[model samples]
Target: MAKSGPNYKVNGKEYYRVSLEIGRDATGKRKTKFFTGKTKKEANQKKQEYINKQILGLKDTKTLWFAQTFNSWLFEVVKMSDIKPTTFARYEGLYRNYINDSPLACISIDKIEPMSIQRYYNDLFKKQKKSSSQISYLNKFIRKFFNYCVDCGYIVNNPCSGNKISLPKEKRSEAIAKKVEIFTDDELNKMLNSDDCKIKYISLFSLATGMRRGEVIALKESDIDIKHNEIHIRRTIATTAIFDENNIKTKQTIVQEPKTKNSIRDIPLPNSLKSIIKKAKLIRNEEKFKAGESYSTKNLDYLFLSERGNFINAGNLDKTWAKFLKNIDIPHKKFHTLRHTYATKQFENDIPLKTVSTLLGHGDIGITADIYTHVLKKQKEKSVDILEII
Candidate 1:
């Protein structure tokens, strides 16, 4: 509570004391520091020095350790932002896996340079054998972190501010990537009829609606309206690394909003599908009663459940799908192939591009266009046929 003051000594000498609020200690108690000087000016000067020391000390605490700064940004900035959990997890993963152990991690933020970062990336590609896309993701994280650094005034400018990272141009083999997998009609019917398909209804839902697996699992019974024959696209469920009670990161299933605004849509369900859903609801009644108090099903009237009457862990989907494929004597293909199959069927059925885009919840028509290039290529051939080209 005491303020700065100058005390006149008996010897006609002037001495001053300034109370510096150094904030609290580990406990909730307040801590204060006093600076004594031979003169008032000296006291003021000492107080200023203490203030700067405290500030620089904090700056060092954050900027000196790259991992600490990364976490600070994660908690203060990224987590507070509107980014999705998967996206936040992805950034965290990139930092932990690639950048955290880099030589740059030990250096102060202000001291890091474009060249140092560039060389770091180059080494990752050469020694670590990082792919272009993976390098690109790491570059993106660095850029975001450096931008945060600039915002915090740790650096005057972002070392990552210049030209966008130029990853090595991928060869055609890599750049082109693999064509999307689409299940044929025969394959779809085979899977549907196979008793070994544990997630048969899930596969059918995707094929009928072109919904993502995560989106389908996130659906609650409340989302389905049998009267209107409509299903609301609201949330998505994903299993990713999440921090536990003791701050230990662990893998868990998290339900969150859809990927994009357009992803939240309503689609009319076919009558047969509606009948199937009614039957499913009846089955879930028994599951809920069986699970009883142990059932962790909250307000979420989830359509699908494991044999244990719990939210289906989509993470196990790959292994489950593998078993299903083996049992059905089918070649290996991803579950997402069903979604592609749906989209392809829609386009092939002469559904308008925009209609298909909206139905698939694509952010833009271009994404639908890119994925269904087969439809466009066929249309081009039809154009040539119209002219009867020589």
Candidate 2:
């Protein structure tokens, strides 16, 4: 081999090269840095940084590629924060899907371009069944990672930083801003007439008060005030995480306070519902006695419980709810649609927005407004009462 200056040739083009002319050294072994610059001096300087980083047992900032940099960035950036476990796991999934299989993994950091990054997203969107919001979130994550890479001098620019990939804009689906079906008085009465007393009470409570399933399960007898005719909603329970198809423990269940401060408010009870709940509470207590178990506050405290007298899981609630609907031979909507029905009825009856917002534990009136826009539009038109003045 011809010994030469820090310079080399590939075909006919010159590549500035730096090869460490030594064997094993104080750090470990010999290293070589090959780079293409307009000049040999630029290449030599680049080589020194590589050698320097190796000597110090650090990654060379100049030579890190997308694959290597992102791996490092996960630890360097995400691991240091106090992010939720679910959120960290999601970021990991995104990186595995987007950046792991690309040519960008081996492509030198300096060579990445906006066009390549745009294509990555375009491919992901085309291939995956993710929602628009999910894709936007993934894009934001990629853009941020590349921005960090640029700030640290691993790359010249963020390939994804300035590029705008058009995601399909999500208009309101057919269900949105549309008059959703709410149970009429007869329909509500038919559902209330259940053979299973547990299902009957659950239906009555949900319809009258509009508490969510999790919120309903988490409710304590102490949360209800018969004299005031009110039920307080303060907390919710949810499964910790969704598991993979393999049934591994993919996530933990969480029992925490309600999502927003407004979620902690009390709902005024209607006279009809107050009477039903009072009778149901008496029956629930009598069953506890017949089961021959000590009725501790924890066991009997909740308004609803399983036959075993434990707080009912949402799955149990769903199963029981489905069975009730099937036995009654009634058309059904999701559990949430019951709450939606309640809110819609309230809006149609001309109850104020602020009052409905508080009952539903909405974070804001805007969310309520968006969801019940169809109900509200109808109510607004009906408010004129043509016979009053004419």
Candidate 3:
């Protein structure tokens, strides 16, 4: 290969030359390829492109469009991975919403630059009024897709890397400043004491156990250990999409493993909650006897069942929760707030952070600390107050 040299004027036109080793010749001799450009940087870029093309074994890198590559990566690569179906659906949704018909999708994979990705993110933040967190989620997908491209030798560098793309500082600050909302004591009392029988037991169970709504609904009668006074969490119900032979998507509910290994755990049940469990079981038994053969055999062992004797649909549960809150004259909060309230109460009671994290089935103690930082801060203040007595 020729040595690198400064740009020189050729026939009154400025030009730069770069030499790169292509491969061995037929006689096993070293072979070099030369690239010429108007600037040294441009010459180096041309050489890098040639190396990328040879690595990909593609005669024309321009033939691979971003949209087509994304689709193929989703179905061929990501689908074959060990991710959950719901996750795959989320990936497809992101593609359809952000990348499917966009100008970035039409660009060749080889031409995608960090600036290109930065512009798309900026547009989403400014023009579409997307939240910083939403843009961050989109960035995660794009970054992973570009990483896959690099692993496949389709590209030399990820356009999303090196902190080249990001949300505005104000937007990022806003996101970080947002705090987790928990139910107030008054709101909790109203929910636990509400006359709405359908949501009452489940709401209390959530407050007691800090289990996610999906994990709570996926409970079976056998999961309740009356002898040990414990509740075992093993599975969760998730809504995912199924693609038919022609690629038509149909939504369905499925019982799958917990979100993380730590999510599968046992919680010590309070005696009051045990009694509530027994009452709920008795009521379900009475309903089952009345329904007789009409009762769904498939859902027999499940603790929470709909009127049709099927597992509770997560969507319907959300609606029921909303109506129950409205009837109780409380402001609407997401169902997840129940879980947050339980965690906050634990911290308020001075429970160990590791114990609270374990009960919540958080994958890491740091996650529990991060989510309940405000609660932890209040606890610290209380401890300092005690020290003032000295």
Candidate 4:
């Protein structure tokens, strides 16, 4: 490269010399040049400085792959976290079906962009036509995946940002009716003296204390407090079963504990009902002994037991309840209606809301009050009588 002579320009009566120099590329492969302020000295300084800095190896992007980045990111962020088995199964299913085993899953992180994510969502909707909620869930997982890529420097930024779809609301179920199934005193007497001792005890205890079917079945001998005249609601017997993909049985059984913490509570039992439970306990022990087993050998502590002395399932309890109602000729009602009936009866007898709330084991008095608004409306109607008398 050649050095050109300084070119001078006069301005404000002072001469300025602008100079230029040309040099080889800093990589030393190509010829390069520099230009500077009105001096040959400055031009040479800039050219030499540029060449020195380049020789020190300051460079730009070399390699970027989407799939490699995504895979690396997956191993880095998601592999160790504790996620629900069901949730992991679903997410992994999506990955296997659509992304993980596919070509797009391998796209370079730097090359991944919003258009790519938008296209993925479009393809999912086009191919599977998933429900709004399903699409929303898939979109969320993809967004999270890309967010991880961004955090790990695999990608400069998340492509799925600002993409969101709202799911439709699910319809609410109608509330159960609150009609009081007030049996005639004679019917009540007959029911109390029913020959089917198991049904009779269950009916008496349910009606007396207003415990739910699950609460009734989950009762353990130890949970009963004879001195305090109370039944402790510790666990509930609801059945969930594992199944093969063909729906063939893997295993089936009962789970203890009611669905909510509020379901565990203390319910005051009627004296008459307590006597029945005490007698029932003795009968259960005698039956166990007859079967060459000890009552102490009973695995579960539930108050109710099957022939095998295990906690009863809901289906079995329902069948027994239906049979008892039919044999007694009482109005047919769902088993849970017994709980409503109990609460309604308490309200009819003018029990305080707080007391009823506690009896139902409601976490909030407002919830107990809300569920029984129909009963409360009646109470308000009765209040008119007080207004008239006053």
Best by lDDT: 3
lDDT of 3 by residue, 128-166 (tens): 888776888888998999898888777777888877776
Model 2, 7-40: lDDT tens digits are 6777888777656653566888775445556578
Error of 2 at 68 (Å): 9.6
> What is the TM-score of candidate 2?
0.67
| Best-to-worst lDDT order | 3, 1, 2, 4
Root-mean-square deviation (CA) per prediction: 9.5, 6.6, 6.6, 15.3
lDDT of each: 0.75, 0.70, 0.84, 0.64
Residue-wise C-alpha lDDT for candidate 1, range 65-147, written one tens digit per residue: 67667777876678777888788788878777876787887876766778888888888888887877788777778888888
- lDDT measured at residue 299 in model 4 versus the true structure, 0 to 100: 60
* lDDT of model 3, residue 81: 81
Q: After superposing candidate 4, which stretches have Cα over 4 Å from the reference?
A: 1-190, 242-251, 293-296, 384-387
Q: How many pairs of residues in model 3 come into backbone collision? A: 0
Q: Which candidate tops TM-score?
A: 3
Task: Report the candidate with higher lDDT, 2 versus 3.
Answer: 3
Superior by TM-score: candidate 2 or candidate 3: 3
